[model samples]
Target: MTRRRTHLRTTPRGTLRAVTGLFLALTLVLTATGCGGDDSSAAASGDGKGTITFGYTADYSGAAALAVAEKQGLWKKTGLEPELQVFTNGPLQVQALRSGDLEFGYLGPGALWLPASGKASIVSVNMLGLADRVIARPDTGIHEPADLKGRKVAVAEGTSGEMILNLALREAGLKPDDVTKVAMDASTVVTAFSSGQVDAAATWYPLIDTIKERVPDLVEVSETKDYYPKLTFPNVFVTRPELARENPELVKKVVGVLKESGDWIAKNPEESEKITADFLGLPADRLTGSTKHVKILPSSELTRLSQDGTVGGWFDRLADIFVEMNKLPEPGKSTDYYLSDLYASAGRTDRT
Candidate 1:
């Protein structure tokens, strides 16, 4: 495969610079306490009827519920005036939450450290790890997991991309070291793989779209859905711990809205996708196949998953991975991050 020259924004040099910034930001989050001012008491005493800011990434599959909720006036129906803000990734949302700039956020496994470090709290789960994939160049002779041995595989070191890569390699009776690993950010990996700098890349959507657009002969390889419940990487909704504790009523209301929105999306996927695309200012068909790639659980399912330890188990497994990668000092219990009582409280109310 010939390398294609393009003016992609995420270059190797830029990513290298980001590595240190990412590390320091994470370090600060872990080491600091009460990063956001003490506003829980003030927010809780109020009637919980005001303009609240909901933060999310530009990812349609992850934040589709928010788009639908806003467009359908669901929040207003419940006496909430919400303002949505889009961020580039989950960590930034965590920062905003800590700084008291945001009330709620939708995030993926990449920001699980927020909860693990007690920097934020996971209020609910959004979806499973369906969007991540391991794709290869057609000319690389790498058609399957077993074919990846000794080949250069591009993956972000500690993100879901690496998790999927390790899982795929294990299934093929191969170790991570069996393949030549190229450490890069998820976005940078997309450009590198498309330009023939790496044989395969473990990344997720919209980035995958970039590779598909630039490289015509992309090979089909493994995806996160293949492992399903065995290896779970969850996209989740989070809020500050103080908010969850001081304002249980508000939490219940938000959860009810999320449930209503998720149910609507499940029943009317076509309309939901269009709403998300339009809200994010993308092509109408940009999220066409997203349903198959991201398993969005209806808000109603949160209570069941919470009661049965399913959601908790997913986070526990994720924490195990973090420990293995030395990102965590030790494994964290699911209760340390997951607020299971929120689901139970939301379920008890008729609002949901």
Candidate 2:
């Protein structure tokens, strides 16, 4: 009988690092793609070995690339043995990172509320979620974006949903208080709409797509614009500064595997959608519809985008909205939280 060796450890952090080196070194033996290639990379913790404990939001498709790559055994292919930590949302993953329960995790604008620790930095933008839309029921007579005025709108407070809704309202010449707002998490936004708990919901993909299928009369109201110019919320992977600097090879492996995942998704869109659908237990169309709302950014682009004012702008816009909502005490600089060097070091030079 053959045995399956997983590159995961449930031990204490110190011992965990030791075992990680052993297994990671062993994993390298399994595949050269798992290690080497980068002529100037090594483990920060001394000898490179063991697996990485990666965290992400399992349900949201924006962060699905990591899960997809993990499912395809690409981590093994790259000589990365990863034990995944799944979270319900970006904030929860951020909490885990803050608590040192996770070395790295995926996040969104929901993290704007967090204070800049200067402890961790965004390694890459996993995907640009042109996410969070204002959807209205046809019965409500909310036709255009302006019709949301005086209507009951469901939004998850202190989240990207509210930010998106607020931005849409501004575009339509309305304010947050103009509409009756109901606070609900992303999960309940759909039910709130289906049960008529609210006239409309400022929600994101998967749910937005689900409401469309479940509520045929659903009126597409508004969506956040590309933040390259608009600061559209992005899903990013954050890692500890020390890990990124010391274990550059590991960082390269992570970013490289993520890029590989993007390529796989491009080549196998249908299979990718089905896997995510089955995982989310939503219809495949819900996943397919999501493509229209998000663009998965490769790590290389993240490397380029992170350098200039673009990503900083996205953070600034988020900080402004969050402060407007009184979600943050003050606006914080996005540059403080993201380290582009790691992505730059890991990015494929051959790609345009």
Local distance difference test scores for all models: 0.71, 0.62
- The residue ranges of model 2 lying beyond 4 angstroms of the native Cα positions read 1-47, 60-63, 71-78, 115-119, 139-141, 195-197, 213-215, 226-229, 245-249, 274-292, 348-352
Clashes of 2: 10
Query: Tens digit of lDDT per residue, candidate 2, span 166-219?
Result: 887877899889999998656677788988888988877656656777788788
Question: TM-score for all predictions?
Answer: 0.80, 0.73
Encode model 1's per-residue lDDT on 14-85: one tens digit a residue: 111122123232233233212222333333455666656677655555568787887777777556666565
Query: Can you tell me which runs of candidate 1 are displaced by over 4 Å?
Result: 1-43, 138-147, 172-175, 213-218, 347-352
Q: After superposition, how far is residue 24 of candidate 2 from its true place, in Å?
A: 31
